[model samples]
Every structure is written in structure tokens, then in C-alpha cells.
Target: MTSDLKNRLAQEAQDIGFDACRICRPWDVPLVPDRLEAFVAKKRHGQMGWMAERMNWRGNPAALWPDARSVIMLGESYTPEHDPMEVLKHPGRGGISVYAQNKDYHDLVKKRLKRLARWLIADSGGEVKVFVDTAPVPEKPLGEAAGLGWQGKHTNLVSREMGNWFFLGSVFTTIELPVDTAEVDHCGSCRSCLDACPTDAFPAPYQLDARRCISYLTIEHKGPIDEELRALMGNRIYGCDDCLAACPWNKFAVEARELRYAARDELKAPKLAELATLDDTAFRAFFSGSPIKRIGRDRFVRNVLYAIGNSDRAELRIVAQGLVDDADETVRDAARWAAGRLTE
Candidate 1:
């Protein structure tokens, strides 16, 4: 009966546009706490203070809800129709991460997860809770534990079938669904992801220093970015996908099923000059349903200015000059930095 129910749940997930689904027991990742502690001890998480706060629940899923017997892991593919790295060559344009180029996955994935969890509750007569990157759940470890994929050297899940271009969602349940075997690390001897990093964010194989990571700087960071790292940022105004894009396993990746995830033309390669003109009101309207909206206009413009500094296009310097005395100190700092670089 458990096996039958699991099969039905998987089918329902695929029918609802999820690329893949697998199950695992909540206590599968025994080493999560130690690994998490080591990461925190090294100050590798950077400004993401929330990672340090949710110690018990983030490291141990079983502690989150003792009644939850199994975790249903789901994968949603958003493989880009074009090469994500191509924009870096065009310095005048800002390169937003492939994931943020479309509608926010948090909203899209959460809606699908809730529907799947609701179906499971009705079929197996048990309670369920769904999560889509919002909670402190160790999603990559849980994804590996559920036989979905192993965490690659870059610290993101990679699947032979799904590749690295996917988002993970979880459904914790009271029903004891049959669990799948965990995936073993298949990264073998590839360091393409490490070499691909523009900022060399990986201090060692299988580890990341979030402080040096461009994704962290543009999104999670609040104030001025270090001058040394600013030039390395290079046209990337949002999250970086270098490591994910460099994975060899992506050769086997399948296209995303959801049309909502397809890239919008305006966001694909926005001109840095145009983005610099986005005041708060315009920024809100432009990024209405996008994940980039969460960072707000000040932070977003701060990133655009950083890219403008790195672009080497003297013409764009005037655009940066306009914001030199902006109200937000962070934006003003970035504008000043850009002006200096362009003038030099």
C-alpha cells in the first residue's frame, strides 16, 4: 500500500508540471549539523545571518516535526534556452541570473508543492506541510537523501537526468512513504565549476565561501561591496550562475515544462544605462512578478552601478554620474565608485 501511494504521488507531481519527485526519511542527513557548524565557524555564509539563527531546524529535519515520517522532494527544471554566460562578454548589458530572468520560483514552486501535498493528504489520510526555499530546510542534502541528486562540488544538487538547472521543493508528511536510496557523489574529478567562478568563490572543492560569491553580494548583501570584488563582478547585476552553467552534467538536462519559467525578453540582457534610470516606482513596476523585486530599487541600482563601473564603456559614465548624490547612501557610494572607474 505504501509503495502504491508513493507511485501515485509521483505521478500527480509530474502531472502538475514538476520534473521529478522522490521520497526519503526525515532523519537521513545525520552529518548536516556538523557540516553546518563547520560552515558557520568559518564564517562562510557571509551576511546571510538567518543561516546561523535556525540551527536545530535547518540542520536536523526530524527535529522540525517529529510526526513527519517522510519527505517528498520535488525538482522543477528551468534550463535556459540560451547560454547564460554569453552576456558577460557584452559589458554594456547587465546579466541577471537565469533563475531570476522569469517569474519567481518561490511563488510558482510553492503553489505546485501545496497542490501535491494536498493530494497526498487525501490519498494517504495524513497531515502535510510544503516548503519551497523559504524555510531553513537543508534542501540540497534532503534532495540527495531522497535519490533526486547528489550535491555537486559547487554545493548545488546535480542529477544525471535533471542536471543542475532545476529548483528544489519539499513536502514533509506524516505518512510513511517508501523511501528511495540516497544518491552518491558523482562529481568525480571535475573542477570546471571552480574554474568557472569569476571571483573564485570556492576556497576548496565541495566548499563555498559565500562572502566571495557574486550571488551573495548582489542579493543578500546590504551595503557597499568591497572594492577588490567589485571589478570581478563584471556586468552581473543579479545572482551568478557560473558554477551551475559550467557543470558537464547539464549536457543531459531537459527543458523546463512550465512556460512561466521561460525568460522574458526585457530581462534577458537589459542595458546597464537603462537600468540605472529605474527609480523606486519604475523598478517596482518593471520587476512586479520577478524575484529581483525583493531586493528593492536602492539595492538593485547599487548593483547596476557596480556593473557600470566594470563595463569599461566611458559613455555609460554619465548615467552613473546622475546618481552621484542620490538619497540612498549605498547608491551614492556605488555611483561615486563607478564615476571614478569610468573617469580613470
Candidate 2:
């Protein structure tokens, strides 16, 4: 009876637009606490103090909700139709991560999770809690524990069916369901992801030092980025996708079902100079539904300045020079740095 319910749940999830769904017990990921502790101990999480603050809940999904018996891990594909790396060649443009190029995945994925959770409760008479990226739930680890995919060498989940270009969401329930077998590592002898990092963020295979990661630098970081790392950032003004795009498993990536995940024409190769002119109001309006809006104008322009500094295009110096006296100290700093680099 439980097997039939699980099978039906998977079909329901797929019908609701999730590419994959698998189940595991909330206590399945026993190794997370140790790994998370070690990462925080080394200060590798950088300014994401919340990772340390919510250590216990994040490390133990069972502790997150004691009543939860099974975790339904779901993968939603957002694979890009074009070469994500192609924009890097055009130094005049700012490269936005494929995931952030359109509607926020959090909003889209959470809605799907909620719909599935509601179905589970109706069919099985169990309470359910749904989570997207915002939660402390270790979705990747639980995804692996549930056989959705193995965590690749770059530390992101990679699937034989969907590749590494999918988002993860989870449904935790009080009703116990049969668990799927955990996936084993299939990244043996592959260092593609590690070598692909422009900032050398990976300290070793499977270990990421967020302090040097471009995605962390351009997004979560609040102040001016380090001088050395800024140069390596290239034209990437938002989150970086170097490592994910480098993975060989992406060849089998499933096509994204949601039209909103597709990159907008303007974002695909946005002119860095045009981006730097966005004031607060313009920034908000331009990125109203984009995940990039959360970073605000100052940080967004700061990243643009870093890209301007790296562009080696003399014409962009005027764009950088205009912001050197801006109100935000960090923006002023980035502007001065970009102008100075262009001058040299």
C-alpha cells in the first residue's frame, strides 16, 4: 500500500512539473553535521553567518521537524538552451548566471512544492511541510540520500537523468513512506568542475571555500570584493556558472519545462556600460522579479565595475569614472578601482 502511494506521489509530482521526485527518511543524511561543522570551523562559509547560526537544523533534517517521517526530494530542471559560457568571450557584456536570468526560482519552485505537499496530505492523511532553497533543509544531501542524484565533485547534486542543471525542493511529511536507495558518487577521476573555477574557489575536490567563490562574492558579499579575486571574475556580474557548466554530465540534461526559466534577451549578453547606469529605482524596476533584485543596485553595479575593470576596453572607463563619487562607499571604491585599471 505504501509502495503504491509512493508511486502515485512520484507521478503527481511529475504531473505538477517537477522533473524528478524520490523519497528518503529525514534521518538518512547522518554525515551532514560533521561536514557542516568542519566547513564552518574553517570559516569557509564566509559572510553567510546564517549557515553557522542554523547549524543544528541544517545539519539534521530530522531535528528540523521531529514529526517528519519521509522527505520527498524533487528536482526541477532549468537547463539553458544555449551555451552558458558563450557570453564570457564578449567582454563588453555582463554575464548573468543562467538560473538568475529570468523569474526567481524560489517563487516558482516553492509554489510547485506547496501543491505537491497539499496532494500528499489529501491522499495519505499526513501533515506536510514544503521547502525550497530558503529553508535549512539539506536538500542536496537528502536528494542524494533519496537517490535523486549523487553530489558531484563540485558539491552540487548531479543526476544521470537530469544532469547538474536542476533546482532542488523537498516535501517533509509525518507519514512514513518506503525509502529509495541512496546514490553513490559517479564523479570518479573527473576534475572538470574543480578546474573550471576561475577564482579557484575549490580548495580540493568536493570542498568549496565560499570566500573565493564568484557567486558568493557577487551576491552574498556586502562590501568591496578582494582585489585579486575581482580580476578573475571576468564579465560575470551576477552569480557564476563556470563549475556547473563545466560538468560533463550536462550533456544529458533534461530540457527545462518552465518557460520562465529561459534567459531574457537583454540578460543573455547585457552591456556592462548600460548596467552601470542603473540607479536604485531603475535597478528595482529593471529587476522586479529577478533574483538579482535582492542584491540591490550598489552591489550589482559594484560587480559591473569589477567586470568593467577586467574588460580592458578603454571606452568603459568613462562609465566607471561616473560612479567614482557615488554615495555608496563600496560603489565609489569599485568605481575608482575600475577607472584606475582602465587608466593603466
Candidate 3:
């Protein structure tokens, strides 16, 4: 009967647009606390101080919900139909990562997780709680424990069916559900992901140095971006996915079925020249439902300016030059750097 609940929940989750689902018993992710501690101790998280603030809860998932008997983890895929590398060819345009190109996933994942949790309570006669990325849950490790995927050398979860384009969510329940076998590593000896990085952010397999990661610099780092890493950022205005894109497992990946993840036309590949002109009002309107809004116009323009700096189009100098007198120092410095690159 317990096995039946797990299988039915998995099927229903797929029906509700989740790419995959698996259950695991309430247990500490024994290796994660040590790995996270080591990573933070080495100062790998960069300027994202929040990762340090929730140290205990993040390292130990069981402590977040002590009463929970099981965790039902789900994966929602956002794999694109085309090669992400194609965006690199258009230097004038900015590449936003596939996951961030549409509706903010937290809203979508939470809605689905709640539906699944609701059904579990109705069918199994028990209480349940749901979480997307918000909670201090070690989501990646929990996904691995639930048999959804295994954490690759890059330290992000990858799977046989969905590649690394999926979002993870969990439902914590008081009822004991049968746990699925953990997914095994399929990475073998391939190092395509490590070799593909423009900034060579990975110090070694299974380890990342955020100091060199473009994703961390643009999104996580608040102050000035490192000069060495800034130039290599190219026109990637948001998160970096060079590691995920180079994975061999992605060859078998499928496009997302959930409309929530469908790439937004405006976000798919925004032109840097056009983006530089967005005033605060325009920026707010442009990214109303997108995750990009969190960074605000100043930070968003800061990223856009970096992309403009790498752009070779002489015509774009006019746009970058206009921001030199901007109120924010972050934006002003970025504009100066961008305009200088063009003149030089």
C-alpha cells in the first residue's frame, strides 16, 4: 500500500507537469554538511553572505522539519529546444540562462508542490508541507537522496532523463512513504563541462570557485566585479550554464512541457543596446514576473553594461556613454568601463 502511494504520487506529479518525482525517508544528508562547510570555509560562495547566514539549516535538511517522516522530491524541467551556445555567436545580444527566461519558477513549483501535498493528505490521511527553493533545505542533496538525480562534479544535480535543467521542490509529510533507491553517478570520465567554462571557474572536478564564476559575479556579488572575471563574462548578463550545457547527458534531454517554463520572447535573447535604455519604470514593467527584477535597475544595468563592454559594435558606444552620469556609482562605473572598452 505504501509503494502504491509512492507510484501514484509520481504518476500524478508527472500528470501535473513535473518532469520527475521520487520519495526518500527523513534522514540527514551526511556528506552535504561537510562538503558545504568545506566550500564556505574556502570562501567559495563569494559575496552571497546569505548562504553563510543559514549555515545550520542549509547543511542539515532533517533539522528544518523534524516532524517530517518522508520527503517527496520533484523535478520540473526547463530544457530549451535549441542549443544555448548559439546565443554566444550574437555578441550584440545578451544571453539569459534558460531557467530565468520565463515566469519565476518559485511560483510555479510551489503551486504544483502544494497540489501534490494536498493529494497526499487527502488520499493517505495525513499532514504535509511543501517547499520550493525558499526553505533552508539542501534541495540538491535531497533530490539525490530521493533518486531524482545525482550531484555531478559541478555540485549541481544531474539526471539521466532531465539533464540539469530541472527545478527541485519537496513535500515534507508526517506519513511514512517508501523511499526510492538513490540515483547513481553516470558522469564517468567525461570532463566536457569543466573544459567548457570560459572563466575556468572549477578548480577541480566536483568543486567550484565562485570567484571565477560569471554567474556568481553578476548575480551573487554585490560590489565591483573582479577585472579578470569581468571580461570573460562576454554578453552573458545573467547566470552561466556553460557547465550544464556541455554535459553529454543533455543530448537525451527533452524540452519543458510546463508553459510556465516556456521561454519568454522578450527574455529569450534581449539586445544589450535596447536593454541599456530601460529607465526604472521600463525595467519594472519589462520584468514584472521575472526573477531578473530582484536585482533592480542599477544592478541589472550593471550587468547589461558588462555585456556592452564585450560587444564590438561601435554603434553601441553611444548607449553606454549615456549612463556615465547615472545616479548609482555601480551603474556609473560599469558604464565607464563599457565606454572605455569601445574607445580602446
Give the Cα lDDT of each candidate.
0.94, 0.95, 0.87
Question: Which of 2 and 3 is ahead in lDDT?
Answer: 2
Candidate 3 per-residue lDDT, tens place, 1-344, comes to 98888889889998888989888865837887888888899999888676788888788877777888999999988898767777888999998888888889999899999888888788888888899988778888888988999989887899999889889999989989888899888999988888998998899998999988888777777867866777999999988888899888887686788877788887778899999999999999999998888888888889999999999878889899999999889999999999999998
Q: Model 1 over residues 300-340: C-alpha lDDT tens digits?
A: 99999999999999999999999999999999999999999
Q: Return the clash pairs for model 3, or none.
A: none
The pairs that clash in candidate 2 are none
Clashes of 3: 0
Clashing pairs in 1: none
TM-score of 1: 0.99
Whole-model alpha-carbon lDDT for candidate 3: 0.87
lDDT of 1: 0.94
Residue 159 in candidate 3, Cα distance off native in Å: 0.8
RMSD (Å) per prediction: 0.6, 0.6, 1.2
Q: Where is the poorest 10-residue window by lDDT in model 1?
A: 117-126
